[model samples]
Every structure is written in C-alpha cells, then in structure tokens.
Target: MTVRVDQFPEVQGVVSEPPVQARNLSVGEVLGQVTELVQAKKYDEVQALLQNAMGQHPNNGDLINANGYVLTAMKRQSDALRWYRDALEFSPMGSGIWNNLGTAFKHLKFYNVAIACHQRAIALSNNEAFLHHNLGLCYAEVGQHGEAIMAFDRALALQSDFHLARWDRARSYLHLGNYRKGWADYEVRLVSGQIPARSVSGRQWTGTPYAGSRLLVLAEQGFGDTLWALRYLPRVKGLGGELIVECQPALCSLVASLGVADRVVAKGEPLPEADYYCSFCSLPGLFTPDLSLLPAQPYLSKPAEREAKFEPYLRKGAGCLKVGIVWSGSVTFERNAERAISLERLLQSVDFPGVQLYSLQKGSPEQELQGVELRRPIIDLAPELKDFADTAAVVANLDLVIMTDSAVAHLAGGLGVPVWILLGHSAHWLWLLDRADSPWYPSARLFRPRIEGDWDHVLDNLAIELMKLATVKVPLSSVG
Candidate 1:
C-alpha cells in the first residue's frame, strides 16, 4: 500500500538502470507509478506493469509486495498470501512487506496470526502509522477494544490526519460503552469520506427545539441501524417539532406504526421542506445517551390486525411455545459473516421439546434449508414475509425470537418480546462489552461466544438455556 517501495533496505540485487521500454525509469520509479495504477483499480494494467517490473528487478521486495497488494485488491487473498510470503523471503526485514502479509492474513480470518505479523511489522518500522492501524483492526476484530484503542492512539500519534484510524478508534470506544468520546469520534466518518458527501438544503439540527418548525430525520446506514435508532424519535418528537422520518420503502408501514413522526415517508416519495434536518445515526451523539437511562421498550406496537390476518396459518398448532429464528442479516454488511452463524449450528441447540421453530431467515441463506433434514419440522415463515410489517405481525405470535445480530433482533426487542441475541464474540457497539442483558432492550438476553470466533460455546450454552425454558418456563398464554 505504501509508495515508498525501495527506500527501505535498499531493495538489493536490482539494476540501477531501467529497461528501454520504461524510458530510463529506475526500479523504484516504475514501482511508484505502479502504486498509482493500483489505486485507480486498473487491475489488468497493474498486472502488466508488475510483470514487467518483476522481470527487470526479479528479486525486488517492493515488486513482490506490490503483487501481493494488487492480488488482495482483486479479491484474491489466497493468491496474495503466496506473493506476500515470496516477498517476505527476499525482504525478511521489510516492515511494509510484513504489514501486507499481515493484511492478507487478516482477510483470511486469522486474527491472532495477523496481530503477530502486524506487531512484527511495527517492531521493524515503528514510525509507520498504517502498521499500527492494521494492528488495531485485528485487535478490534477479536473484541479487545481497549488494546485496539491504544493501537489506534499510536496510529493517530504517528499521523494526526489519519482518518481511517480515527473512524476505527471511534468503533472501539463505542464498543467499550464510552459514549462521551465515541460519539464525538464517530463524526470523523463524515470527514473521512466513508459516506457519500451530503449537500443539505437547510440548517442541520443539533437536538434543538424546533417548536413551530418541521424537522426531518433521515434514516442512514443499514436497516438494522435505523431500527435500533428508532427509539430516539420519541425524544426528538418531544422537542415540539412536526417530525418527519424518511426510510426505505420496506419499512414504511412498520415505521408509521410508531406514530411519533407527523409523516413517515418512503425514500423517493414526495418530500416536504423541513426547517432543519438530522441523520438518525447522529441522534445518539447529540443526546450522548446514557446506557442506564434507556427509554421504555415496546417503542413499536405489534399490529394486532396483522396478527389476526395471519391467524389461520398457525391455527393447527395451538399448544406449543412458538419460537422464531433469523440466521442472517444484510449480506452487504462488511461484518455479516462475523455476526451470522450457520443455520445448521443453531439447529443443534434449538431442537428442544415443546418448542415449535419457524424459519424467519430471508435472502440467499434460505437456500441452506433445501437439503437440510429436520428431526423436528420447522415452518418457513420467510416466504410469507413481504416487509418489516409482516415480520412484526408474525413476531406477535411468537413467545420467543432467537436470532443473530439482525434487524429482527431490533424489531422483536423494540416490541417488548422476549428475545435472545446470539452474538459473535466481537459483536457491535450497541451490545457493549461483557453484558448478559442489553440496556437498550430490557427483554433481550445476549449470548456470546466464550472464545473468539468459535460458536461451539455459544451453542452449548444456548442448548442448556433452551432446556431450562422447555422444562421450567411457562409457555406464554398468547403463544400457547
């Protein structure tokens, strides 16, 4: 990733004179040009340049490392590993090469090994900001938020304007439940250009009372995030403004049920001019929410009418503890694989007696059920679900909802349903660090992997908990 390819260790055994076609460009100069091409995402052109450079400087560490970085950018981490190792052989003491190797390992989910590799890189070249930033990322991935924050501090210390480090450090702070600093640091994302640049037509709201004015609250980020932040609309409504909430069409009905917003508009719908506007994610920062002071739950009501409309579907099963499960969240989320678990693994723990299971899972993962055998039959509810409203309606009939960190968790939690959130050891900031229950959702219990990246413990503990529920807890009167 670094453009300084040959300054470190002198890139020994390379000819000082350039090849004729390169127009007298030295090896370092050619590789420096290669970096620009890589950044432009001209992968094929980058390959051609690297190939020619490798031919001229056969043992150049920078050329080998650049090959690795390009392969990584091309979504070929496995291939990148081979090139990184080759680079390390020639430039064993090259810190940047070591950093690239660590990055490849990080992509492959070998966090501990990647951590060590990054540390080695730092030991060799302590002044590089990115090396510390990469190390911090691995630490955060493993749920060591404090250590990650320290690493991020070192990165920022080395390079004060390192936007990515600031953004990542904010995540670490939020995960540790330090809203004071986290919320402030989180604003760095806007400055880092991680999101599309916005052009606001009016003044930005900063949680001020708009007494006689209309204030727009636009939903941003993932659906799950919007769902989680919906709890704050009531507070904003309390500010005496005519509130408007704009969201994706799929959530229009569910969001409207809150009735806090004077108007709930779907994206692309005709919009009303507002005096001021604020982002949904930005609300938490403005309030600096105290975890212990979470507002009352059931912020969203389960539409009793939809429950009646779907009554015939569950009529045949009258006397069982109805449970719903969602195995995956939005696939586009960068950390989807970390929060999501295999449906098969969850089934191992959820097949307890007196419980009727329903598959609330949606999207491509539904294909996982095609060849799966069931010792106990489960109804697939996802086929009937048309939107968040339908999901909430079905949720009304269930005594319990067990799911990974998906929007369903937020939906059920907001509805005051008894929900269990299955989390990766490295869960999101909302779950906080070392908690069995959530301050945001009083009825929700969190189950985390005892060891990082291993779901065996989570399943084992969940099975025992389910056994207790099956034998000891009374089935909810509504469900049974």
Candidate 2:
C-alpha cells in the first residue's frame, strides 16, 4: 500500500492511524495485513511492508512505531530502539511510543532507562495498566520487590483481569517469603499461559480423604522444583490412596527410588488409570501453607549398587573433610547468570585446609575447569556422573556438600546430607529472604550475599565456616 505523506497531520498522543494512502486504503488496513504476516511468521514480508510504509510516510508515527514492533519481534532490540526514537520525534507525547521504547530497553537490560521510560508513559497516561505492569517488571529486575508489588497492585486495581500482572505479583510475594498469598496467587499461572492446564477429567486432589483410590500427580516446572515437591508425595500416599507420579525423564529413577509413589511414569508417556490428578507444585499449597508444617527430612535414598560403585572414590586423606561442589546449573536457566559462579572465582576465594573438594558440576559449565590454575585439588567426578542417582551416591559419601543454588542442593537436602548453599542477594523463592536456614531442607544451611553480586563476601564467610568444620572429627560411617 502507498501513502500520500502530505495528506496526513503529525498526530499526537497514541498515533491512532497512519498517513492517508494514494491507493485508497486506510493505513489501518495496511497495518492489519502486516500484522497478519507477522503472526504467520513471515518476518521477511513484514519487514519489507514496514520499510515500504516508512519510506512513503517519512513523518508518520504509526508506521515508524510498527517498524519498531517488527524489529523487536525479530530480536533486533538495538535497531528497534532507533525506530522507537524516530517515532517519538514525530509524536513526542505518544504514550504508546514511550511504552514500546521502555519494553525495547528492558530487552537490552538497560533497566534504569526502561523504568524512566515507563514512568514517563505513566505520567502521560496514568490509567494504562500495561505501563504499570512494565514498570513493575523493571523494579523487580532491580530487586525492589516492594516497589514492584505496589506497581503490580496499581495495575491490578485498574484492570482486575490482568492475569500477567497478578502472576508477577505472586512471584514478588513469594520472593519476599509471603507464601500464604503467593501460593494462592500462583494459581493464576494457568490463566497467564505460564503453565498449560492439563486435560484431566477427574477432580483435582485437594488434600481430601480418598481411601483406596488412585492419584496421578503431574510434574511441572524445573528439576529442582520437582525434587522439592516430592516431600509432599508420601503425605498424599498416607491419605489412603495409591500414588502415580508423572515426572521428567531424568527424575523418574530418582522419584521411583523414594518409594512415595506406587508407580512412577515419565511425562508424555501413556498413563495408567487414576481417580484424580494434581500438579506437583500445588501439593505444597494444600499440605504446607505454613512453612513450619513442612516435613523436611531425608526422604530419598541411593540404590545400593550405585553407592557401592562410588565407594572407591569416597576415600579421603586422614582427618580430612570430603565436600562435593557444584558451581553451576543448567545454562539455559534464566537466572543462571546471577546464580552461577565461575570455577576460577570459587577456587581463588575459598581455602579449605584438610578438605577434599569433589566437582559435581556438569554440562557446559564443566568446561570452565580446563586450563585454569587451581589453588587446591578438586577431583573431577563430573565425567562419570550419569544422572541424579549417580550424583546422590557421591553426596552420600561426602562429609559436606557446598554448592550454588541448583538441583544438586535439592538432591543433597533430600538425602539428609549436610549441605551449605550459596545464594545471591535476591535468591530463588524457595530460599526465601534473609535466612541462614530453610524450612524445606532441615539439613541444609544457606549463605547469602549481603550485597547484590558480591560473591567474594559470601565465599569468605563460607571459608570461615569450612575452617570450623575442618577442626572437627567425624566418623566416615556417619557422614551420610
């Protein structure tokens, strides 16, 4: 579609329409065609259409803003910022342009600039619920949960049906240790498209008596989350019903060994008949609303053969503390950049005298150990580590396990091993806030950075604690 540039005025506010076209078509019709192409994943066609539109209507804010949208969709966020700036020049007071610019800045991790842009959008149009939601996201990125929650509340107050805002508020609440409201609000995950609702025709298990029936517990979220939620499975079994746990492939063997379920099935496989179904995470809300009510103990055990296989690797020097260490988790995890520490940094910061450090790190992060000068010895056991079952055997043989927040921490805690977990300033919701201990893992101790991103201080504190452990004497038989 072609537009006549001289026929359109420089519209202010939101730029509701593009410049008039010579082809006898409204700019909205051309934009609608572009939107259809974008939705169909024809990005090349959308880009050509947007470029053509912008060339014809050089001063049109709508065309420029649409170009920004297309660029952002293409993951060219830096280029998107340029187009957004050009759109703002044509319609300086447009709240939509300001909001779009803020979102683009957020993608580039310029959170402070994103916050300023969102606030400016709010100043121009105070009732825009999405602007408040965007502002809340910026606050949450900076670890300002209070401001984030307030912004989310404002967004919710303006638009009660804003499930995404409610979902984010729930995360903020959980991060601050307000589990009572957080779990209830967490149900909005289904509505917000964070979790797809299963097509189970049976009733959801709600902690009610179900004598002699079968319950199917569906797994959701990460590996650590599944391990943490397994603590409630035995309770479900005790309610006078057989349990069938649907879990990820990596966790099927581990979960089956726990003896909490009558049958363990991997997710996406055909399921056996059951009377009811429930999400693994929803169990905590039903059974342990109060943190004190959680049954935190050694609920998992390693197979005898697996334990026997690693027995030779458990040998330690006289009077030395054997400690297993994990410096990283899944690289694809969103918060891994903040949670993971480099092997070089970990080696330089802590000195464990009379201690044997065993590496439990796996995947791509394990590659960090190559060509690094080690201040102390760390036995590389990662190459032989096949799965969680193998990792559990290694933990069972250790006197202590020190690691960052990962599934290994969950494995150690579930096996009742003594573990010290290093956490970032704004750690996961499971760790909660400002605590050295966890209600979910009675045997686990936590060390958190006093300041954000200050791993040196956290490692220094851990080193001091390790010194105390080194002075003590414990029998190898009682290590597990």
| Candidate number achieving the greatest TM-score relative to the actual structure | 1
Per-candidate Cα lDDT values, in order, are: 0.81, 0.79
Model 2: per-residue Cα lDDT over 407-435, one tens digit each:
98998999899999999876887887778
Instruction: Give the runs in model 2 whose Cα sits over 4 Å from its true position.
Output: 1-49, 74-79, 108-113, 316-318, 351-353, 373-377, 450-452, 463-480
lDDT of 1 at 93: 91
Looking at model 2, the pairs that clash are none
Worst 10 residues of 1 by lDDT: 6-15
Q: Against the true structure, what is each candidate's TM-score?
A: 0.88, 0.83
Which stretches of candidate 1 lie above 4 Å from their native place?
4-26, 36-45, 373-376, 471-480
Kindly report the root-mean-square deviation of model 2 from the true structure over all alpha carbons.
Answer: 6.6
